[model samples]
Target: MGVFSFDDEFTANVAPARLFKAFVLDADNLFPKIAPQAAKSAETVEGNGGPGTVKKLTFPDGKYVKQKLDAVDLDNLSYSHSLIEGDVLSAELEKISHQTKFVASPDGGAIIKVNTKFYTIGDAPINEEKAKEGKEKAVGLFKLVEGYLVANPDAYN
Candidate 1:
């Protein structure tokens, strides 16, 4: 399998604690509500989002993906997820999964970094179109979270 990397970083206007809590801790509940068209819903299938937990995401188009919580350290401000099954995009490249980290900026905002590794089979190569789609998805994540915070400033408390 060939591995392709996608990296994205953004500085959000919200505080680190706020973005982390809203985006990471409560994402299972928050994201679906905010962007129903993209994500139909998400739920805690097992455990409480700590290491060893699992979350299931249902796409609007009826596709589903299972995520295994690889590591989560609140103090370190990082968490990672590996694809367990259900979606070919993740199932095919199970080893190269998704990870996100948050770091507190000295200026009171937060730096959010997200990375995903895509895997493709055979010599045909992972289509560049798919890679472009992945990049757009990363950007959409930030926009989704930011939109939520903008609409409901007091949320995630």
Candidate 2:
């Protein structure tokens, strides 16, 4: 198998703790509500949302992915998950792991850092186009969440 990894960072005008609560802890319920175009719904299919829990995210196009939670550190504002089953994985990927960290900024906002590792099928290289597309979607989701928080300052508090 081949593997490729990349990092992305985003700055938002939201507090780290609140953003972490909304984006990391409550994403299953918040993401779809905030960005219905990208995510139609999200549900926990197994476990209680901690490590080893499996969550499914359904998109507007009817495609879905099941991801297993690898780690979650609320105090550190970090989380990790691996895509275990999905149409996206059925193509050319063996698996994909994502780690995200949210740090407090001096301005009271937050800086979110994302690390993604793509594991490809045997002898096949990771698709850069797909990776780029995924990054775009992730950024869009973050922006949408940030906007929601900005508009509702009492949210996620």
Candidate 3:
């Protein structure tokens, strides 16, 4: 299988700790509350809510994704996971992995970095456009969460 990787970063006015707590640490409880259109529910389906644990996220459209937690470093505000199942996985792909880090900027906001890797089944070429589209969705979700945090200052603190 061939692997294609991509990197993405975005800045937000919300604090890094808050973003990490809401978006990464408490995603199952926060995502559905922040963006109901994007997520219907999220739950840990296997193991516990730690490294190697599996989480199932159901979308409003009835589609879903199974994410396996890889590493989570609270001190560094970083985490990584691999997508193992559900609609997000295409037939041509083996799995998709992501590493995300949230850093506090000088202004006390956040600078979020994400590295995504696509594992293809064979010589199948990755479609750049589709990859970009997926990234856009992720960015949108982040923005939605950012907006929620900005509006509710007491949240995720």
- CA-only RMSD, every prediction: 2.6, 1.1, 0.9
The estimated TM-scores of all candidates read: 0.81, 0.95, 0.96
Per-residue C-alpha lDDT of model 1 across residues 1-157, encoded as one tens digit per residue: 6777878777877777778788778887878888888789887799866888887889988898787889877886787887676763633344447788888777877788889876556433566675678668867887789778867889865
Error of 3 at 18 (Å): 0.7
Instruction: Rate residue 68 of model 2 by lDDT.
Output: 95
Candidate 2: tens digits of C-alpha lDDT, residues 31-124: 8787888889998899997899998999999999999999999779999999989877856798999999999999999999999999888878
Clashing pairs in 2: none
TM-score ranking, best first: 3, 2, 1
Which residue pairs collide, candidate 3?
none
Of the two candidates 1 and 2, the one with more favorable TM-score, higher being better, is 2
- For all candidates in order, the CA lDDT equals 0.76, 0.90, 0.92
**Candidate 1 residue pairs in clash (backbone atoms < 3 Å):** none
